[model samples]
Target: MLDDFMTRATLAGIGVAFAAAPLGSFVVWRRMAYFGDATAHAAILGVALALALELSIFAGAMAVALAMALTVSALSGRGYAMDTLLGVLAHSALAFGLVAVSFLSGIRIDLMAYLFGDILAVSRGDLGVIWSGAALVVGLIGWRWSRLLTSTLSPDMAHAAGINPRHEQLILTLALAITVAVAIKVVGVLLIAAMLIVPAAAARPLARTPEAMALIAAGIGAASALVGLRAAYVLDTPAGPSIVCVAATAFALTGLYSVARKAR
Candidate 1:
């Protein structure tokens, strides 16, 4: 099974979807889309760091993504507007990462693979890492579901319930870093946030409850992965973007459904 690239790619996509679904829901609820983008973009810096230090790319990506997320979380509410701060950090990290990559003299790295993913080249070890990260994320989110929900709904309410909103936010930050690390091989840095948001956005119209939204988003994400891989193979298109395109299409269709339902 692992010998087949398509099978591996399919499993990788499903694994990422599982991890992203719950975290994506929290991101949407907290209005943290920019936050997600910033963290993902920082993965490039991780790639550079990995190459320079001869460490695992996954380790480098996760470390930098964690740092980026923590920085954003810390800097938030320190006077700068959220959007402005994220915009500055996101682009700066990406630019610095690109510069860092250019400094790697002897390495013959393919930037496009990191920037846009190389899911079809995933190995059995990569699949193992993806599934492990996915399970950890899902377990972490599930364990903190109620508290996270309460904090997301209202910080004050969460404090009253003896839950620390900051702690919950930290948990999410950790989860986001893990997701970025594992998903870099599936959708790459440029489109990771789309995979995180679009499926959740698409699921919104069909779900009446938060739990339902997470499940539906997971389904949509997994479906997009499978469909996108087939489309890419048939059309000779890039696999990562094709997956994101399917998800974007789902978002558009669901948006239309929402508007129609509201009118009728």
Candidate 2:
């Protein structure tokens, strides 16, 4: 029974890793880590809405993330700094979510679990949602990889080449929303952004191309999930944080190696 439980947890973790790694590569490349954090912080509001309306957590998170992305995209055109806007929205939404959760009197919800995640509690149905969302995200990214690369490398160049940077941005934002929704369940709102950034960061120094970076990020993420799960099991620690620690460790090691190579 214990073995079966661990197997399911591990599988779920792997799914999260696969989904997070590729998307995280984009996040790192675009310097959208703060945007990711903003979207993820808003997920708590989605959780509250889900509980209030009896909707699925995944659906609620996706809805909120999509709304947040749209809001940010629209606001980006208003001449305000993007980081400032993201900071306001992220913290404000998190505060509001906390207040909303406090309003529910009867049920005792573990806010920490939602904030930091409880991956061991993931159900088979949740796994289905994670995989389906992951497939959609990966397929969309793959289909537009060239365009995305063009836009990321140089918006002016992409525009000169007739690719619509705005449209690509929208597509990437949508994909990010889906990713945040799917990942929130695995790593929770507070830590979801880490899952999206850490593995990609770790892979950056080792990659020579955008595609190589993404693939390596995915491999690192998958390995982190497995290693993190093992650590959690042995140390009786929380799964999500343990997984993040592994990713961070990898990032540190990669950074050191890069520095050494540069010095040589």
Q: Report the C-alpha lDDT of model 2 over 72-162, residue by residue, as the tens digit.
A: 9889959889999999999999999999999877777899989998888877777788889888999999999999889989999999999
Off by over 4 Å in 2: 1-3
Best by lDDT: 1
The local distance difference test score of model 1 is 0.96
Candidate 1 per-residue lDDT, tens place, 25-88, comes to 9999898999999999999999999999999999999999999999998999999999999999
Could you tell me the lDDT of residue 149 within candidate 2?
86
User: What TM-score fits each model?
Assistant: 0.99, 0.96
Off by over 4 Å in 1: none
